[model samples]
Target: MRDRIDEEITFRKLEVLLAFMETGNLSKAAEALNVSTVSVHRALHSLEQGVRCALFRHEGRNLKSTEAAQMLADVAQEVLALMSDGIRATRDAAGYSSDRLRIGSLYSLTINTVPGIVVDLKVRRPALQVELALGSNAELLDKLKQGTVDAALMAVPETEPEVDALPLFEDDIFFAAPANSPYAKLEAVDLRDCRDETFVSLGEGFVTYHGFVEAFRVADFTPNVTMKVGDIFSLMNLVSGGVGYTLLPGRVRGVFGDKVQFIPLRPQYLMRQTIGVSFLRARERDPNLLALMAVCRLRTRSVG
Candidate 1:
């Protein structure tokens, strides 16, 4: 029988091993993890000790995975994935079992769509509570995928195998610039009119970015991004600051003061993004989430 180490192992230790496998060298692994080589080395050693065998064979500062470790890598990934799934399910239950509903959204939705829906829902369910999580579309989608959120209002991706989305409303993108910015000078800006202009872009995980990218793609062009920020509000602020032009929604203008101006797009290269609620496939069976979805649909359509 194989012997287990006296001490217990942890998720962090397994994560370190995954990092090591991705990059065979400890230094590189630590670099990827933003940790010191010594810390990573210690973690690997701890994992090896717990498993009662050498996972990696090292010679002259070079590390090579043994056959056992290679086999275990697949198991490690599965275990980690399952652990994440379990944690999310538990957390979702905790979040939902209470009076509160954990909701997530893309930056654009946060500005008007989510607020409007939430306010309306609050009026109807005065006893209910809400917790908001904001981020890029990808971030929210990842959360919804894992059952970390009761629901999310955002744009559907080009494709998601696991997600079941109900379309709330489809809205077009706008060419919104600061009131006095150069892009606002156009009498009517064509899709290709701002070809060489610098755009203030949304950071990763945004459905706005996805829609913006698709607009450019349909125009057969790419944006010259001068800046990328984590939230759309920041992009609007930068636009009002006259940093650069940004592609945004008409509703986004409501959030800014007179300092910002947005123009209606020609929509020649248009892709209308849908704002809707998404939840885990399993949770669709839940009465609470489904009940929440109905409120979401009503609020999104009537949202001002």
Candidate 2:
């Protein structure tokens, strides 16, 4: 009957109309929305102006909704619900899906750290489907920036401007050797003591690889690195088979089993891996990420 609903009519105006209609009082509607009563009055006025319709009748100090206002209030609830669902769907398509979580982690964490976190996350969000990715530290960071993964669990000290890190726990680095190796009998081994010993190390881009290099640097000599491998387990296996010794996270000792021994480094040369979750700062507010971070915080607190 009247002109078509104006383009200026917005979802917020619809919300204000619905709140006022349901409450039947401006003050009540304002209380619900945590806004001033005057603000609620202004929103209703704005809605009327935008739609070019009288949605309410002023009766003394109280406001009464007209027939048309009652009808619009009922429709506004449905419209708001539909708009919310549409926004959620759009976000899911843009990679912030709540139904599923895309996660990245280091190969070293697959044994213990990753599993514990995954199990805890599933327990907290039972309906959430988890997609796991494993890679070297650099590779996982790259995947995070590219949005190929929503969050990553990796060794920390990450300084990428776009990345937000939450350190879970600290893990000591140690020299891994065959259980039968002579050095296994000692409480600690200085990096210089193994100067002539052949070393099997993780390749560049892996966090342990950098730590290995720094340990040697502190010792003032280069290691006789015989092989540069990709995975920590492979490097450990090589060490256990008497191929060569390798430096690794002590937390993985349980994974490598009794075949390998983890010897702590001298205090001054000690390098600890700060294992944690890393994600884009932009994704910090994403529902899926917020849920994952909550689980991580609880788990880390229990461990600490």
Candidate 3:
């Protein structure tokens, strides 16, 4: 019996089996389950095959359950009810209520955007508990896909079928240099003008790194990057200490106080980053994700 049960029975088959018994018609069962009639027929056939028994009697365009099928349906009802109760209890024990949200963001946003978003989310859901993860663009997106984080705030991801993103604001990329540096005086600097300048850059995996590569490619010169730091704050410190210049989004302008200058690149370079919230398309219907998206929409106008 154990071997037969292992081969033929499954929770999904049990659900279809019970639904078929309750409706007593394949089409009605399909409607109740919100599935196609063909799907209900296939599931019933598969269930019979797994149990290695004839569980239904064919009656001219209708499927009628046998005594064995009726007994299985009764057992299925109790099992499904108990399983539902178990799931609810488990969720309660794990503190995984709908009010909890797992959010991810780029480290740069911690300076402004994240703080304000958290405050807004708390206002809307007074009992909400937020778990925040701050990392590079690559890391945040990976976590979203893996389901470790529910939502992310970062540069708009490149085209991917699995990801769903909502664009919040556009941030122009700007050249950052020490306040006393010669490049700091320029209203706008041509990328080619900085060809010989030593530069500090955020390491690979960061969105800014890719933007820098594109900007330099357009300028048709590889920058002499002297340092590759992991975080924007450290990169900003390197530039402010006169080690080298770097590029960053306009949103981070307030971080450096008066130590660094932010000069927009010439329009010809076309360097800009669009900030957005990203999540797996599969998680789109999640209640916590919906709440975070609401906050994102409300805060969109406030972002520069």
Model 2 misplaced stretches (Cα beyond 4 Å): 1-11, 17-34, 45-83, 95-97
Order of the predicted models by lDDT, top scorer first: 2, 3, 1
- Candidate 2 clashes between residue pairs 3 or more apart in a chain or in different chains: none
Highest TM-score model number: 2
Which RMSD values do the candidates have, in order? 17.9, 4.1, 5.1
Model 3, residue 17: distance off in Å is: 11
Candidate 3 lDDT, tens digit per residue, 91-206? 55433456678889998999888999899999988899998998999999898887788789998899879999999888889888888778767788898988788998998999
lDDT-wise, the better of 2 and 3 is: 2
RMSD of candidate 1 to true structure, Å: 17.9
Q: Where does candidate 1 stray beyond 4 Å?
A: 1-98, 182-187, 300-304
TM-score of 3: 0.75
Candidate 3 Cα deviation (angstroms), residue 257: 1.5
- Per candidate, the number of residue pairs that clash is 2, 0, 1
TM-score to native of every candidate shown:
0.63, 0.80, 0.75
Clashing pairs in 1: 136-205, 137-205
Error of 1 at 60 (Å): 89
**Residues 14-89 of candidate 2: C-alpha lDDT, one tens digit per residue:** 8888888889999999999899999899999888888678988989999999998888888889999999999888
Q: Distance (Å) between predicted and true CA of 50, model 3?
A: 13
Q: What is the lDDT of residue 285 in candidate 2?
A: 91
